[model samples]
Target: MRTLFIAIASVLLAGMTIMSCEEKDDFVPTLLLDVQDAIQVSNRGGEFSIDVLSNLSWEANTTANWITLEESTGEKGKRALSFSVTENENDERSSTITVHSQEGTQAELTVVQESGLTLNIFVKEGAEGSGKSWEDPTNLSNALKLAITGSSIFIAEGHHTPMNIVSGGNSDDPRDRTFEVASNMTLIGGFPAQASSGATPDPDAYPTILSGELSDGNNSYHVVTISAPQSDEEQVVLRGLTISDGQADGSKSSATIQGRDFRREYGGGLIIGGSRVVLENCAVKNNTSDKYVAGVYVFDEAEVTILHSKLNNNASKSNGGGLWANNSTVFAYHSEFNENSGGTAPAVHAYPNAEIYLFNSEIRDNKGRSFGAAFYARADSKGALVNCLVTGNESTSSNGGGGVMMYDNCEMEIISTTITENTIKGPGGGVYRRKGENILSIYNSIISGNTQKEGTMNIDVYESDADPAKILASTSGEVVFDANGQIEEDAAFKAISMLGDDFTPIGDDNPALTYGMTPNHLKEIDYLFPESEKDWLDQDFHGHDRSGSTTMGATLPE
Candidate 1:
């Protein structure tokens, strides 16, 4: 009986081993992907693959419809599975693709793609079709409405008035007519429609104009309004266009003042609020306003940059015939302000807490009835003028500062600049500093050829004592003279005419030619206040390099 039991046990053990071998042969497989998390793709959309390390029948599925696999179901064994995605035209997008095996094992692959590029719109003169191309162009007003963010509007040469503008109130009132600019859009003018490739467009030759003319006898409105807030990453550019013949009467309502019965009229040419605007190689001229800021008004935290532009022949009833900055920051580089007339500040007016930076610019032939024919820095404001020219400005009334005026608590710095040929009827033909802790620093500059009927020729610091020695002693920095600098002498400028193309001063004998001192004080100020270098001191008015040897005035003697 024991021998028979041992035989049965041996047979049972052999059968059990054979059954285990058979079970191992029929084992189910699992899915294993090389990359289970993320895969980056290009913006134009392309094919990509993932390694599938498994011996099983697997099926693939995508969470987003933009992703598609080459084969939905496949028998994989260490093979690369191909997949493709469509082009991402909008923002950045992501998708997930899952591979499932028969054994219930799953792996996911996340795909990411970047956004596409922006669109470009075209506009040509006398073209009456769609604005998609140069051959079929549209009007300026239509293009403005059709433009979205990340769009470029290229305008050809023509006189472009505000056509079919949306009225602010009444359609018959010219003050209600408004032309608006969208955020993150660029308007580039002065281009010939049929220009050859690699050829630079000359703004003088093309001459695109934005005129504010109405046929119905209504001529009282701001020509352009930039009220859109732009992202910090991108700037809204208005370039190579002439803005002219704008008239802003008091018919339109604005922000109410405390003492005034009605809101003040402002910005006959352009009005900017809560926006980031850049004006490059443009012209603003022949504009008039009843109250303030006939040329351009920047208010309510707007940041404006004017580069290689011109503001001329603008008139205002109150202040800032060229530009008025109220609670805003303005940067003027290689620009010109001329023949602007205002009641207070003819060229520029910076209000309380406003910051004004003038670099390599020219302010000339401006007339102010009260104060600061060139510039006015109000209480608590800050101003810097570097390598600038302030000449031929007149302050007719008894206020002060034919070149520049600084009120109580205002701080100003002038470096490598020339303030000459200015006339004031009362005080400070070159510069005026009001009482109460005002700071004025001058270095490597020329303050000559200035005249005042009542007070000083170069600088006047107002106080009860009004002593020249006390005033010079109380100044913040060294008010030293430049090389060959003359005080109250004739600048000896030749052919300083107001003709169309003869505005520049001539003659090699002019003291302003090579009288500038090196801008060492700018480096010192930069070290003391690192943030002050935003007002550039490395270039002249005509975009010429200002190296060790610099010229005093705005331009090289030519």
Candidate 2:
């Protein structure tokens, strides 16, 4: 009986060992998540939780810096992960939290957070409530009436027109409609719907347009008129707004400016008169006029500041298609004037008493019916173009200057500016001098790739042949310098930013990257007039910090 018991015990032990080996061979680690759906967070952001289940030791990791986890590692069974997400001020984004077990079992949880939009007075199209909150929103016209000194009116995506506009002062057309803003306030556009908690707002995506198509062909004379006093001190700001489709219908009053009979028919898209205004990330475009100064008219000692803005596709009958300044001042930074047509200066025109300071801007693809496709500075007009790009401008009429023209006694300065690829039918390919003492003081700049089909190549002096050698080495790097280069072809440029031409120089093949000095304390046109716009001299077109030795032509080499 004892022998039988021992044998049975031994057989039982052997069977137990076999069963243990089989279990070890067939074992598999288990890691499971309680939730498979992704976690969602609002733009306000807050704390959140996720459930996890595992049979072995597990660890959690996330690469996103915006996410903060309560614990990184855990062991066994069902557990809850506590985490928080910060508020997103920019675009909406997403990230993944990876959960890994000791036995190579893994799970993932995605976290998506929306972008933020701030507003003091919300304006949405077809809203029935007040302008206090997103839910109780109002229209742009209503919000404009309610905006105060410190108020920031946020307009949502829609087409907004003027309700009540008058020509004022018994002018020619009293029925002309326009959106008139005359307060020290700010108008910011680009907002998702009030009920959309998951969407982000991009100005290009959700366009908030202020159109002037009042009734098809009978459009307003001016789409928007900014008459806000002290708007030049940045007291009034228009950001991410599109002003378009203005067509001048009625006649304008006549006035004498700079001792000349200057017609006051101006500003089909925007009008800044006797006040200061700021346009940031705004588009003033697609306007038409039978008179001069079609796109934007700056007059009456007004100051208009343009930052990262665009004036394009405007047509005029006489002088300026994109911008016209008369006894006023315009300071443009990182702005663009493109595709304007049918004027003396298709892009910009400064009257004898006006001044325009352009920095890190682009003048491209403009077509002039007469002279000066890019810009025209009349007698006694003075300004500066610093680190700007001028290219692809054309002139169909037989006059001068496809890029720029300087009349007698004008004083304009160009520093580290690039002028190239302009086609002219008359004298001067890049710049023209119509006799007299026109001082085009060019310093550390380039005049290359210009085509004069009927006359001089680059810089025409007294409507004669250009002295390229003298213009290249005239004082170079100094205040009274004249620096010019003829590279024939600009193959070293990177991607094209405008007019199918790349303005950014790249590689050692381009000399513009190393031919520049430090940018600071630029020379002004005058002491009392055309005051220097030194607000962003130390910054480049991309708003990158530029110090020491840097590249030229409104941008750095790639």
Candidate 3:
């Protein structure tokens, strides 16, 4: 009995030893996660994924879950994480995997998106007794070249001494001869980093101040030639510069290019080529071309955007004295076009093929010789004005538009805007729509106190033709207004009144502000204004509660 028991016990012990050895052979090492280093990302929007490496098993049950990956601290609060494998390699000895995560979204990886390569230009008084009393502008050329290689160029605050650099480079290199401003490259000048005491005051405060000068040879040779070598999609941006005095054709200037015409010379500020460009926070003033140009000129194939800028006191012989868009696409936001004088439309002149959009802007105090005193659109030109103020503009034409003139099947949409106090010498004082099919859309807008020195009504469409039938009432069309079913004829003003040259419209306890649907265009946009608080909708200038139950345009009276 004892011998049998010992033999059985020995057999049992041997079987147990073999079982332990098999378990040891099957054991898989688990990888440990370190807590310190981790990936970072931006918290702007969207979910991020993170991958963790593991060699234990291929089963989904063995894979790490979100809860296991998350780490929380008493002071730091809860952490969120999602996991995904970007790249993976499976092997018995080692497995590698790239993991992505939104874990520390607020904790972003260090990224520097340099707005652009900058050209810092410092212009100071020339050295005394050096005979260089006249500051040479050649340095600007060199700096411009260097800046062109990069993204953008900034011309520091300083008066540019008189010097002419005809853009045409060496005769051999035609491309070089043509001073080409490439895509995504900006040329900025006279932009104050911070408010300065003695620098040029804000044009809003003082409109008559002469802030910029150009002394190069007095001929019209393209001073600033804006072009986009790339396709139209990739646009170049130019802003914050004061450009003037550069001639298009003159003795000291380069040979006249095809677009160059002293009488028809384009932009005194910028000659826009076939490109989609943006100009922001700038001043296009004191620029001139004899024929059909103005402070800012847009050609047939160009698409331009101007925001938060000033086009003031510019002169042109023919078209737009302030801004001209000839068969182009243009958009202006939160801008001021004021005190400009020209032969045709003074503030803005658009040809038939042009499509223009104006929002939260002001066009006032402009003088024109021919027709449109404040704004002009002709030949199938389509324009939309939203939350804008158009007033105090004058026209010299026998049939003129103090506020706006549309001809040749032109279409216009005006919404929640104040078009008042405009004067025209001719028939259609406030607005003139000629033989062309003109469509006007006015909604939640104010049209009062407009003068047509000799025209029909405060807001007149057809001049000589007194046919009320011909008068195109402000309606929906190629022109459209967002009334949200609440359209008003007239709201009596209370105690508010217009004051000073500013003439900023004051809101009363009118139904327009209290009960109105904010224009649809203003509702959907990314507002990028420079403000500390981010309460208003993106790109909306009218300080209102955007997320409220009721929709409205621009201003929301408290």
Candidate 4:
């Protein structure tokens, strides 16, 4: 009996040892995965897979309803698990899929989706609830947090400041909060929504205002800043909005242009850097900066297109008051710059390889303490003025350009533009041509009523190159008026049709009306916004058609 018991014990011990060895040979110490930190994806729902390497059975599960796995349970041995996601129609989302082994070892895989345009993010003032639906609205600062790429945020009709401050030990309006708008997004204002039926979305009637006037006279640095790099081809668009009452004060920044270091605080109303932006039917006014530009500042790689907008009544201590571009481009279509006062160019200033292209716009009633009253442009750059009215500007500083100051080596093409009633305290009432042989091609344009305190540029400096300007008829006179109110040069040129005195179709014959009405006699004119195909304005500045009246100016008679 003792021997039998010993044999049974030995057999049991041998079986137990065999079982332990088998389990040890097939054991996996740790489950390791070779995957990216995060995966970036796009709009539509599609199949995605991830490889899992293990020696046990694994099951995949996700909390997001948009995610669907083809197979939940899998025998893990370096195999790919396929999953599908639904079409996204909201803001950008990040979802994670948790994978678990039979031994309770968990791993996560995350997928990120880009924001879609179908989602509507409505923002109003003084609402502190969830911003999901129209019934519960949020403030602009909160909505900006959810504003990702390719998103559209609708703002309501109220005074929306960038920040709402609460006084405390150190929380008393630091003046650092700004509307840091992202690239490839749209911010449309003038929306009034409550529960269901919002207003008809009239910008003027609703009057959505974005003010930077913080309490206790603590102003923000910038009202709006569009400085993010683009993920797509879409631009940062602001439509039917008003950017006003901003004061860009405090710490100055440094910008380099043409190997020169410029230091100043820039862009009180709007500052654009390394992005494409558009302002449609908007107004940028009542903004102030200690130095640099007050209304708009376009930096490197930035393209700002203003269509049917107004830049008025902004002030700066130096440089541009309305608009300034440095090493970038600014194109305006049917826009107006009026009543901006500053040092240098008050209406518009382009410098250090920047370009300003204005088509069918008006530069009027601006005051500049120095340089050009309408524009101060330096050479090593290019610009154009087509179908524009430059009038009622004054260069307060002595020996400045009344209408425009073209300094150093540069090129500007003036076609079918009217330069009238602009005065300077010094030379170049029409234009101050400095240094090198500047390229000022005044083709088929009118230069009248421009004046300087002394040595007016009407016809005084014909000795300069390309000067005895190729001019058309004028309403009054060029700078210093002559007996005949006409320039001395007789070079006749043809150009595209621009605006008359009131941007009204030429109805009455002015004093310097000398040419005849013939479209075939005009040369082809290069205009801006080639995407619109036909160059000339279908409707004039006031949104009125040019009635078929054969006139003497440069516009094509329909």
Candidate 5:
């Protein structure tokens, strides 16, 4: 019995030894990925690098794949090594390596874009009749010459002396004659119209003018002909400047024959024959031409964006006293046009084959003679106005659209806008959508307060033989407010107070605050539930809360 016990013990000991050997073979350390170091990021080529460290049995582990260092450029590369990771070979303490691949690697490379520079522009200040004074340091006419010649000129906040810009190179003289606005630049002036002293004895006279006078050290002599950009990447940004009285020099005989002819041919605040231009926070006022034209005339398939600007008090002989766009794609946002008069046609005219988009803009107080007061769109024009205000416009003798008068076969859409307070001497005060397979869609907009000399709310659809246009509206949406999330009718309850002569707004318990609400479109529900949160009232340009819940109008304080 004792011998049998000894044999059994020997067999158990042998089994236990085999089990221990198997457990030892399965013991493999985990490979750790380590990347903690300063990396070189190249902007020109979008290259970046990060070092990686691995400390484990990488040789025998055939399943070990790679160590990836993720970056914002979205690049990832892999390498497989067959070796036990030694401290010297596997530990990358301060090694830098390039990431040659930029693919689906979003790990640590989220780049947040910040706002670009703010360009402020100032034009002539001190009242309309006062000659421009240099008391304010921002008289940048001379610096503007250098800036307009290239890109990025910041006009100061002082009244500019009456000046003209003449291109140094003449087409005929060739005496080192070359003038160009050839760079992607930001020109900023007319910021807050400074107050200074210069005598403008004639109350009717303009203090500063940009006319066709090249020889008297004035630069505006060279017509700003919009030629093709030398490169597609170039941009021209005009901001915060006032352009007044850009007249053709018929009064001066010394003006170049070509220059005078160019002025006579194309005269306005800004004449566009180029592409990809942007105008923001500007005022184009009181520009006139003898021939039929517009305050802002665009042609030749230009892609123009007009934002936060005012085009007012301009006069023209024929079409488009305030704005004229021909065969172009134009987007206007947060803009205003007031009190423009046209002799022969509409205040805002779009030719055939034009695509115009207006967003959160106001068109009011415009007058025309024989046609629509606010807008006259032709056939083949595709237009859309979202959250807009078109009111208080008039026409003398004809079918006038205090809001809009579209011809046959035109396409138009309006969303969440106010088309009210418009009047006409003849027909169609609200809208005159004429005959011809025109498509008109209106959703969530107010079409009230428009009156004719005889009738009111005159929406004439297909008065002649034309296809009835479609006017669509959301069943739940209303237009008595603006897209800035306020009620338009509420502003009428409280009288708005002006802080100073600037006519900027300062809100004080106005009832016009609670109008627009888009709950489903809310980015965050917490915005409406700001319980015990501090009120951050931001004011607009006219010194009012642009996004306040207590006031009306566009000026929001920052």
Candidate 6:
């Protein structure tokens, strides 16, 4: 019996030893994930981390190109896996980082990066909340501050004045007083609280105004100034606003070159320098400047494009009451310049090395005290006017060229245009070229009813003899010339009236209706048009189809 009990005990001990060995073989550490299901990041790019609660080794990997894991592998026991993302320039994106343990357990952390923000502004109403929607619109001043690059600002209808305090002082500095637009930004006005079916806002229904009403003694400020440097990758756009009441009195100093003090009153309404600016459906009126360009000024290699806009009732003490461009490229299309007064070139003045293009527009009812009541091109400037109308413009000074004045070494081309009813106090009521060898080419155009008060010549090339055939040519239609490109017959307009925000010609017998030849240069320079603009050269200023009978002036008869 003793022997049997010992054998049973030994068997039991052996069994216990085997059970212990099996338990040791099956031993494994537990692994767990302690992190949020998802996380959010800004569009500007940032870093974040996730906590891993595990008793084993873990690894993490990202599934997106923009997202990257900083620490892909980590040890056990509450380890942090870091990750980062790049700046989101296109749109919102999402990615996931999967963290897996050696025990085959896995966890995911979803990351979402947002796109750029767009703000809204309503000056009439108060800003009370975030400016993401119409109901929570902010002020224009605040919206400009909150907006980042590539962001857009939609301004509702109201008169928005500049913030009087910029960088804490109201000094004579333009950067401190004017409304400065940032680079790569789009500012659109004339929007209602809610838009209709159409994507574009109607300027007539929602009249957005930007006024500069702060009277700082005699030193006035410009309404808007764009001095930001723009590249080919980015552009700045300003549209659908009435910019008025700007007053620049030539009191502020711009520079001291050669012991002379230059003024900073070039642009009363807007000044664009070293920027790429586009102005569409805008009205710049009722602005005054003591120097040049009461309406708009472009300088320092700026590229400006103005389309379907109006520049009226602006006054300048010097040149270019409507527009002044110095060493810049300016393209004005389907626009109007009326009732502007200045010392010279009431409608437009182009300085040396400036390139100006005016197409399918009107320059009328303007007064220049010196020369070029309609348009002027200084030395070494290049100007082209296509299918434009220059009429009812007067030059009050003793200089010539009420319709157009081209200085020495300037080049000007007028194609399919009309020049009528312009008066000059000296010579060349229709057109004038200065004494030097300048080029003034007129093709398929008309020069009629222009009077020189104190001179006999209607089109004068002062001391620069020009051949009538070489200087004037026509491809398809007759280039009308009545005694040195001046016709005594009436233009026979239905009415020369400003009728309710519309300039209309009501007569069917107008001479400009049937004498026009569309040139190939119109399509070659079509790149000047904005991306949103359609083929407008085939259309009139009133949006009438010109495929039937192309009109010489800006307007087409219905």
Among the numbered candidates, top TM-score falls to 4
Rank the candidate models, highest lDDT first.
1, 2, 6, 4, 3, 5
What is the TM-score of candidate 3? Answer: 0.59
* lDDT tens readout by residue for model 3, 1-558: 223434544554455445546766663332212221232211111233322222222111113221122322111111223432221112111112223223321221111112232333322222122111123222344444434223344344454432323333335422122234533456545533332333442333322211224332233333456654334334577655555543232123333222332222556656676667888777777776565555777774688889888889877766677787877888888899999887878888888588877877888899888888888888888886666778888876776678878877777766555676787877555567787567655444545556665427555666455333211112211121233332234433221252123333344443333443433433442322222212223323353343432223333334
TM-score of each: 0.68, 0.66, 0.59, 0.70, 0.52, 0.67
Better of 4 and 5 by lDDT: 4
Which residue segments of model 4 deviate by more than 4 Å? 1-118, 164-173, 193-198, 254-264, 459-511, 516-534, 537-558
The residue pairs in collision within model 2 are 231-276, 232-276
Candidate 1 per-residue lDDT, tens place, 168-258, comes to: 3455555555566744679988888674333345789999888776666555467777755444666689999888877777544753211
Whole-model Cα lDDT of every candidate shown, in order: 0.70, 0.70, 0.51, 0.67, 0.47, 0.69
Tens digit of per-residue lDDT, candidate 4, span 425-469: 787776666766566655445565567765455323323554443
Q: What value of lDDT does candidate 4 attain over all alpha carbons? A: 0.67
Question: Each candidate: RMSD to true structure?
Answer: 18.7, 26.3, 20.8, 14.8, 21.8, 20.0
Candidate 5's residue-wise lDDT over 265-315, tens digit each?
233566655456787777777766545554676666767788888878877
Better of 2 and 4 by lDDT: 2
Candidate 6 residue-wise lDDT, 1-558, digit = tens: 223434544554455445546676664544444434666565667676655665568888887999988998988656777778898876677888888888788878788776654434333333555677666667676766666556777777777777633322345553345566644578888877464333356678989887776544332357877754556755678889898887766665553221122246778888777679889999999999877789988887889888889989999887789988888989988899899999889888888789888888889999888978888999798887766888889988878888889887887877656677789888878788775667777654555557786645556777746544223322111233321345324443222331112433334554455434453433443232243433555666556766755345455555
Put down candidate 2 lDDT per residue, 1-558, tens digits, no spaces: 233434544554455445546766665565555454465565556787776666567999999999999979987656788889897777768999999998889988899775454437887877758887777888876776555444688788888886555424224443266766655578888776553323345798889898888754567777877665453234678999999988654366633221222233778898776767789999999998787777898878887789999999999887789998888888888899999987689899888688888888989999998979898988678777777888889998768887778886777776667788888888777788785677776655666567776535577766444233224311221112213333323233322222123556555544455545465523322322344455445666666666774455566543
- Greater TM-score among 1 and 4 belongs to 4
Cα lDDT for residue 179, model 5? 21
